[model samples]
Target: MPMRGLTILVATGDAERLHTALGFAAATAATGARIRLHLHEGAVALLAAPLSAPNDPARHKAGLPKLGELWEEALGLGVAISLCQSGLALHDLDLEKLDPRLEAQGPVSVMTGLGDDRLVAF
Candidate 1:
């Protein structure tokens, strides 16, 4: 049987949460599973092209990669990334501020469009 695709919903803005979600994507993709990362609420911040300040001291701890490095790894693994339309607006972030590779998707489409894909939340 073919490996299943995964749809990950990331709604938190915290760096640790983002790290966890992206790390999961990396590990899953390494196993040949398709990955779709949906960014909503504060999670959309992860896709910002400009690097955020290195404020999270814990990010430098052993073994864990920085948020930007995780993002690049996910992209390199060909993970399909989407940003929530309303979620972006609510966060007061202009669509252009995000990485151009990320598609803008509405809630209805995000929920219903995922077919037989496993859903994970962060």
Candidate 2:
């Protein structure tokens, strides 16, 4: 049987890592595999509204999609993107400013929801 789904844990603040994670999520989701991308720690910033992609110009100039575009594509492809609740608190980010598409959840909730999905961490 084919793989059931994929769970990606993104906990870094690095732009390249975030870009890659979203890229994988979008691509995997396009292949019809269920995808859940959980953002914790510094990665939570990606969900903030008016999303910033520091490497966007360079990536765009290099003929690649911008990071924000990749994120939108992932959402369009049915990737479930979530943010860690404690990560918001730890970073002092205003929850109200986050992307509404994201499901705010705790670690336990995320873990319990991962039913046999392959896990990948970045």
Candidate 3:
């Protein structure tokens, strides 16, 4: 039987791009699809703590929900989230910032683990 799986690349620095990528991955995994999400570049911020320096509530609230919310939703639906080691170092973040279910891998290693299926980049 053919395996149904997806590995999405989230390497953009744009907030919207990162959020959209996660949304797509979450949606796919919601339907019992096996999924892998790779976070790189500024996209690593998606797995970080909510902003504390302060910003416009309108911008933040509307642009995307807090990372915690997104993370929870993905975990609830059994999606696997991960980080790019290089990207994490560049952004000064660590595995503590990621959900326990998520992994920290090097470059495109996560995609390689997916074993030939759909691959989307945002």
Candidate 1 lDDT by residue in tens digits, 1-122: 87788888888776667777788888888888888888887777655544342544566566566777788889888888888887778767787866677788987888897898899988
TM-scores for candidates 1 onward, in order: 0.82, 0.87, 0.75
Best model per TM-score? 2
For model 3, residues 1-122, the per-residue Cα lDDT tens digits are: 54578888887666666667767878888777788878776777644656222323554668865544565787788877777888788878877755578778876576558676688888
Ranking by TM-score: 2, 1, 3
Of the two candidates 1 and 3, the one with more favorable lDDT, higher being better, is: 1
Provide the RMSD of all predictions against the true structure, rounded to 1 decimal: 2.6, 1.9, 3.9
Badly placed stretches (over 4 Å) of model 1 are 46-63
Residue 21's lDDT in candidate 1:
79
**TM-score: which is higher, 1 or 2?**
2
lDDT of 3: 0.71
lDDT of 3 at 30: 74
Clashing pairs in 3: none
lDDT of each: 0.77, 0.82, 0.71
**Model 3 alpha-carbon miss at residue 82, Å:** 0.7
Clashing pairs in model 2, backbone N/Cα/C closer than 3 A? none
Report how far off residue 97 is in candidate 3 (Å).
Answer: 5.1
- Model 1 TM-score is 0.82
lDDT of 1 at 23: 81
